[model samples]
Target chain A: MKNKKMAPIGVFDSGVGGLTVAREISRQLPYENIVYFGDTARVPYGSKSQNTIIRFSEQIIRFLRTKQVKAIVIACNTASALALDAVKDEFDLPIIGVVIPGARAAVEATTNGKVGVVGTEATVQSGMYTKVIQGMNPKIEVIEKACPLFVPLVEEGFKEHIVTREIIEYYLESMRNTDIDAMILGCTHYPLLRSKIREYMGDKIQIVNPAYETAMDLKRLLEEEEMANDETTEHHSEYSFYVSDAAEKFRKFANTVMPFDVPTTNVVNIEEY
Target chain B: MKNKKMAPIGVFDSGVGGLTVAREISRQLPYENIVYFGDTARVPYGSKSQNTIIRFSEQIIRFLRTKQVKAIVIACNTASALALDAVKDEFDLPIIGVVIPGARAAVEATTNGKVGVVGTEATVQSGMYTKVIQGMNPKIEVIEKACPLFVPLVEEGFKEHIVTREIIEYYLESMRNTDIDAMILGCTHYPLLRSKIREYMGDKIQIVNPAYETAMDLKRLLEEEEMANDETTEHHSEYSFYVSDAAEKFRKFANTVMPFDVPTTNVVNIEEY
Candidate 1:
């Protein structure tokens, strides 16, 4: 508990999209310190190949290891889908990914056994969610759709815009006929459009946000492994944000999405790693 | 002429977006051989920093140099805006960028001495068009708007979708009341949405595509420097496409946008350069 309390937990993503996950972790575990890295220089890892994604994830993991993190979270779904297997065994720390927790959540929440997943092209192509959910329960059916435009729409700050609704409808048109009792927001950016997605999918469908479940899973793991910070420290937990490019721009964007003020944002020369 | 005829003209962009420029170049200079490199692995250069952009441009330039190109065209707006000056003097060859040519055309086409420029956030933020336009003709009024979402919208193949129309209208809402007679499609991707943009802006507004002008500029430069392939050869002019990631994906996307069939597409290890 003492060693874990002092060592910060690392979180990383392709860009500011993973802040949603980090935000949840901060809320769920107030005592834990967080060290976050966003690969803002080369973002939207969803479009890149598996080799590139793995290379990038390894670099970020190596950087985080230098920060002395007790645990690491691959906050980007694309990275988790494509890079988890390559890095999970290499590191000594408990490394968690968004796919498994999200898949488990969808499996638990689905009453009709039919669950839907929407993510980037790479995430959908990797079929990580479907694979994990099917592994958890062989009978559960997974319907995965690649929502390529959602990330851009979200980045453009069109979460509640009318065009966003239209795009959502267009992407989810096929799912309308299919009976999906629970839908998993497979991408970190998708959670921002929760209301619009919910509005489009109707009241009966449950939108499962993996970020929430991921935070819960981390909490459970920490407790189980006796890594939970049981000490009541006088100092407030700190959050450090690092990005590969334009720290100020990332800081400004983070302020808009994050509930708390981002005070310590720095630029990291990721290539050196 | 014989020496230049054998040496292919080089063109590069951050991703498939630059295929628009390559398409125009192929149309305007059908006889000239072309070598195009798309940095698909680290695309959307508009979001990256100036230093990183310059580094990428230099690497691509080095790679193109190995191909023995007579001249190089910076097909990407962001790269032209950020890296052109840095690399132009470093290399002995005559290098051209899209910004200057587009600005020149905009200034020439405008009757009201008022021009509008729509591009990526980084391109618009760089103020390259405004600077070049004002440098060419100080009397010409340049109104610059960063249409950040256009690239993603185009990549998502929403060029003719209703939501795309809505998005175009939303982005151009501020420009609707302006007295600008000419608007520069500053980014290569913007030209793909030319018809939709023209429809939204009405017939009175002349859309100035930089890719067209850039190709023309390259043609003129080749002629002026006696680098034109004046010698008629029996062999057909070849086109080679290289991407930092998935060559097949780039080839497929290029087929949809390009008029000619892309015959030789290969993957490049850009970082090694």
Candidate 2:
């Protein structure tokens, strides 16, 4: 219900995975309204072409802009890697992506020079994390792997299953073989499988969730722009959930995984935008 | 070049998995001109809603109809399960789907009356195979499980990897525990993982690939209707490949897993049709 120009922050991802980013935003900025959109119909942007990813992101951003949100977050790693640059200049508002913030966090978290990043095929292939990390600190050793199966594994609610652990081992084999002190859970969905990934990678390897870092980045930008919601005025945070398709399915998923209660969700025909 | 009314069979799937069905048709009817379309852009229709899947199937069917395809095969199991009935009457052509043929094959192959089926979530939920099989023989029992990760696993080309075998064990544990003598690889993408599935299920269970059955079903319809392309003529069979996106990627995949060579491929903006 908070429609004041500075009251809402727009968050969007290819699918429900974006909720992780939104969850962090809610935790960090409780009084800020969140307008979240999930492209559920054509999700798993990890395997899609860059053009399609950009097209979808632009459509979602267009839809979000109509809501008069103060700023936007590209919550998905694949979308951040492939579509962020393309949509950045076009959208008139302040927009932040997960890639740079995540890279910065990984750089800060690592003790040893060895760092690891795992994400969808498109995100890993984009090399955004490696480029940003190595650019920030030239001596850091970056190990990257594309864990394309992680989304499906998490979506299937197999996060703690032995199957997931084996899969984690399978995907993290290259990362595990190294002496990486910090690992970035590059994809938004990867955070859901953090327990299995941690169990497989062992406690020595620090796990970094970019959703947390992206939320922190949003908080900083909001404060700098003087848009932070005044939390002391007895104003409660409001959440709006939208999906391209399968509203009920998204609602069920959100209710289970999200920290806040998801009472209802609406469907948006994202293509029209 | 075989556009002479009834010279070509239109075959389509969500993506390359339908290539398995295309491969089967190519193997069974070596002389039939095959027009294959892969909806690579909006692929893995397996997890999508019925309405979306039906809409996608109709678009692809309309596209294939333009090529003068006499008979059309819905190679993708999810589309065939959810969309075939919706599109069958409107299309004015002899349309065949994989579900019925697959059910028939499973019924014939089952000795213990307990038949197992593995497919994407949507296909399993549709229960088309169960309905068709039970309608044919009421005495038989059907045990169905949705293996949502199998598509991603195969798409990642981890068909024979230890991870795949372990994941297969995770999914098929229910079926493997049953007295089911035969199992249907209900999703077209599945045949690519045949060896691993067979290895996991052991040699006792008869593995039924619906693509092969669907191909045989098409063979029957073509012969019955006198639409079979004559091989004895100076005509050599021609194969044309089209995808909604990623022509080069589809070409590469077809070249690797197809029964024949894939020299070239074309991209189609399926939405425009």
Candidate 3:
């Protein structure tokens, strides 16, 4: 399946939240080269209109095309919700989005047939999770709340704190009253706040993380397509990172999340391409 | 005291929150050029470490230096709280941060000498606003709360809504009990939630927006330096915008925030520079 020695799997997100997905892909397929584009400058795409999200995502896909990626992962919840269909139509490569995998996982995990979805304003507004889940089982009840602060709280590194706890409790107040068996961490960054989320929701509710499930799906897809790299190649696989904004900040964040060498990351300007 | 053409005053923030500052600057200094860089990708810098904030501030300052800016306004509360000192030492140009201007304005507005500050976790944690307010007037009592979700809520375009109102009420519960005469919209983005903030605090508590005060200070500085651009100029005056992530999204936000078309806007991977 390994015909090309140089082609990379391209992954892009509005910002660092997509790193959760990228980290998963790298862990599952260590041999495959990865070229990641983090639109650190114009991230948190969840609040913008559908037309704007599509336009922004198209530019990212166009940028990735230049990198000659085998497939593109729309690793953003907002983009996945609003622009996935259009992106699939526009691009020739296999395009995967977080919403479907997340939706499927949530549906599979739900025992009461009641699912809860939380994300940015844009994601909640799209009703992507509801549509996908309904498509599979129309009987399932879906409850959605836009926890808009989760992204910034994660980005700001508020994984643990009394204030964070207070905020999480306040945000999850709506779901507590609902009869939801499973809750989808609809946004990629939501995983970082999982402990806080879990604490607030208690042990009864199941949590679904699309980033993790999507990684597993990607592994299966590669094998089915005969695109998996052979084990014979002894060369150390490389990851080239590009961020639309501060490279140093990305390096710091990469170190904190992935525990990798900072110097090796190469920052590229996405617009110039 | 005026030159025919002087470089526009450069203003930068983590996201559209800086628009409040930019709009004010444009209003006060109609004749000058304005260049703004919003690190939208890694915004909500309030929770990041001092070192990371300083590093990010340095990169933005370096970028603004290329524009030959007469002065630089660190419109971000997180950056101002954590990195303003290092920024002032590193650059010779006139620099202003929202915290001091905001603190000063709050102190001036408070007839009762009670001031409240609300921002992201890092800004509140650093005690930057409290220290600045105390530095101005030690007798003035300051109450600080980290309204972590405020930025994300505003960014998500949740300016007015029932749920948004509910969340604002929940967050402002502490302030409602406290007797604060005036409150500083510490974060640049906080002003966008003005109605919500105003509704919660009521008219009795004066709200001081640092963005507005910062713009006035910037205008005064330009005039004092004799660098103010005159009305008569041979070349067409225009504003250029840059972001670290998606150009399309930035353009849309810029269009919404600015009444007129931005001459040019693009996403550049800031690390390559």
Find the candidate with the highest DockQ and give its number.
1
lDDT-based ranking, best first? 1, 2, 3
> What TM-scores do the predictions have?
0.95, 0.93, 0.64
Question: Which regions in candidate 2 have their CA more than 4 angstroms from the true location?
Answer: A1-7, B1-7, B224-226
Candidate 1, B141-181: lDDT as tens digits? 89999988898888887887898899888999889789899
Residue B14: error of model 3 in Å? 6.8
Q: What stretches of model 1 exceed 4 Å from their correct place?
A: A1-5, B1-5
Two-chain DockQ for each candidate model: 0.74, 0.59, 0.18
lDDT of 3 by residue, A96-206 (tens): 998889999998999889999998878998899999999999999999998876776676565664556756776789888888989999988888888889878988999
Q: Which lDDT values do the candidates have, in the order given?
A: 0.90, 0.87, 0.79
Residue B71's lDDT in candidate 3: 83
Residue B34, model 2: Cα distance from true site in angstroms: 2.1
Q: For residues B97-188, write the lDDT of model 2, one tens digit per residue.
A: 99999999999999889899999999999998899899999999999999998898888877767778778888898788888999999998
Clashing pairs in 2: none
Candidate 3 docks at the CAPRI level of incorrect
DockQ, prediction 2: 0.59
